[model samples]
Target: MYIKPLALLLAVFLASLRLAAQTAPAGHVVVTHLDSKLLHGNPGGENPRRRVSVYLPAGYEASPSQHYPVLYYLHGFTWNDSLIFNQDGMKTLLDQAIAAGQIRPLIVVVPDEQTRFGGSWYTNSATNGPWADFTARELIAFIDKQFRTLAKPGSRGLAGHSMGGGGTVRLALAYPGTWAAVYALSPAFLGPHPSYLPGPGVGPALRATSAAEAQRVHTTLAAVSLARAFSPNPKATPFGANFPGSLGADSLARRDAVLARWVLASPLYTLPIHPAALRQLRAFAFDWGAQDEVKHIPPTCRQFSNLLAVYGIQHTAEEYEGTHGSRIMGSTGRVYQQVLPFFNKHLDFSP
Candidate 1:
């Protein structure tokens, strides 16, 4: 009896070890280096040599002719391609989801979007280069050519968190014909430029002589980064950027002009203009945490969902029980349970 019980315990321990090994694999991520023509000569001087992380599902090597639908996942502000490569338990969750047959096998791509000011926000800026174009055109073209991808809009999906979520919403709306589905998690959605202006010292901080000083003031750096994205002035001194009220003086006229441009870039403002474009999408969904640190995000997400409803555009929006950074790790099951299944249902995985 003792011998039998000991043997059973040994078997269970071995099985657990195997499961752990499968869940976290050091070799899961494949890094590809690309010399981007689109990123060349950016005023911010962000690296043109980029590293893209591609996660291949199990048996990808065995299925030589099976082309998989591609899901392009954008990381949050201050994050790079390494988010998917190492942190966040994304690979482990994906592997578990695939192994469990909860979702079909698909290719996941995470591209580096880090810029001089931390993140590009996945927007096209005179200073930051055309990130939206890079994602919708250049990156897609590169992936289809290199990987065994479905190679069509119906099989492609875009998803992101935080600033990347903002990018997902903007890019998907701007290039409705390019993506089959889109999912945004705790997106940083701005209403207007005037709404972004912070408390005192913001104006002076924007005038910082060095990148270190500018970045030290987080709120000011964020404002400046958005300015670089929306209202870049290549001739501006120091940072070579200008916002609505970067100077100590505030001008309503100048503020309004810049705010108008920002509103135009906003998904809330743009989605209403192109209701038909939104309606044509196969799937559109966004979710935010109830306790998101960005207090405005939950309300913004709700407002955006309502706008879609008003326009008669079909989409899904949800409020989950968590904070902004709560669900990113595989521990939460949001990606496996919600995100992957949404894409599975929408994206065309045939052939």
Candidate 2:
């Protein structure tokens, strides 16, 4: 009887140890509500205060003196920062990768870039406020100050999907000295001289007083939003001066002017002009789905890649078997196997 009791106690203790190990925190996902002064008092009325999610690897707390490199992730059009952790399983994937020694542990940050018009495309605008500045300058400063980071451009990496991917491309080029490496996943590239016409009912729909009415028409609304980011005219009536003729006038001249503005913002056009900046990056890579639903994405990405090749800029470009937003979840292994390892290889993690 004594032997049986002892055996039972041992079994219970072993189970308890396993349970404790399972229940212990793998890492931390801290959500901080940041009030961006850079985004304050914008015409769009998008909330200046936004949530930024920071992922601290396991042992971050224990290793007080040790600093880690930082990776800034930009999300797609509709997806905000929180989705990276809550829905996409970023923390869990990172934990598993770190445990397996597949990738070196580092800090990851996701900033909210949602606007009244769905997504900001991570651009600076009179209407959308200085979103690029908010991300590149202000947010970086905040992260460096708050966390124990390597805090240098050489130690930093940027990655994004879709709109965020486009942001990574634009931001990396514009701020050449900011990030050492860049990975753009299925970036939404509109080409150098995109000819975008306002969809049916775009004019009357934008005139609607409420946000719901404006958002009901998806395609036109998205165009207007991009126009708001690129060519914002606060003086224009109703919802400010947007592309494809603001509100009333459907003149060809006005439309041409709008397209001209968009051309100026296009990475396809800007990349050729800024070859030196592209060459300055330590590492650059972009990938798109083989069957990307966005018709323009693959061709544009290929064109952009060709442009890079023309300029003798070294970069990685791949086509994967997935659609837009399909591989975002940790189930895909793209983030764990590809993105993290890319950053680990390029980013300087010393000291």
- lDDT by residue for model 1 (267-336), tens: 8888877777677789888898899877778888888888888888899999988998887557345777
Q: Candidate 2: lDDT of 143?
A: 95
Q: What's every prediction's RMSD, in angstroms?
A: 4.2, 6.4
Give Cα distance to truth, residue 173, candidate 1, Å: 0.8
User: Each candidate: what lDDT?
Assistant: 0.79, 0.81
> What tens digits encode model 2's per-residue C-alpha lDDT throughout 84-171?
7888878887776666566788999999998887788888889879999999999999999999999999999999988999999999
Worst 10 residues of 2 by lDDT: 193-202
TM-score, structure 1 vs. true: 0.88
Q: Tell me which residue pairs clash in candidate 1.
A: none
